[model samples]
Target: MTNFDRITVDPTVMSGQPCIRGMRLTVRRVLEALATYSDRNELAQEYPELEDQDIKQALEYAAASLDDRVLELN
Candidate 1:
């Protein structure tokens, strides 16, 4: 599957949070990890279920989601 295809959402999983390959790992969770860990390698060691492509695509997907939104400053 394409890296983007690795992202999926199901109400039964993670209470409908966006997840990777229908697994318990949510995209948001991974993105948050990026904040604490500077190296992707450390992330891999932390979450063995994650592949490089999974991390790349999750960022792509999250960025795309934000691009679709509009934020206004008051």
Candidate 2:
């Protein structure tokens, strides 16, 4: 697994959902935001606390999570 140093999971935060550096901002949310924002500058304007590395790790973490999982087709 890739080192997701920026991704964190704390039961006290967001019900243990994977987050960015233990912040309330979730990896899922980051992915969603990425889809909404046309550019990194726009994303940065929206989430000032989020750094470039945080975004990078969030993407990496999401990819790793999917790679480690299996889903049966209905």
Candidate closest to the true structure, highest lDDT: 2
Query: What lDDT is obtained when candidate 1 is compared to the true structure?
Result: 0.87
Error of 1 at 7 (Å): 0.3
Residue 8 lDDT, candidate 1, scale 0-100:
93
Clashing pairs in 1: none
Q: What's the true lDDT of residue 21 in model 1?
A: 86
Cα RMSDs of all predictions?
3.7, 3.4
After superposition, candidate 1 runs with Cα above 4 Å error: 1-3, 68-74
Local accuracy by lDDT, each model? 0.87, 0.91
Residue-level lDDT of model 1, residues 5-48, one tens digit each, is: 98998999999999988899999998998887899788778898
Q: Write the per-residue lDDT of candidate 2 for residues 1-74, one digit (tens) a residue.
A: 68888889999999999999989999999999999998989999999999999989998888777746588999
Report the lDDT of model 2 for residue 69.
55
- Name the weakest run of 10 consecutive residues (lDDT summed) in model 2: 61-70
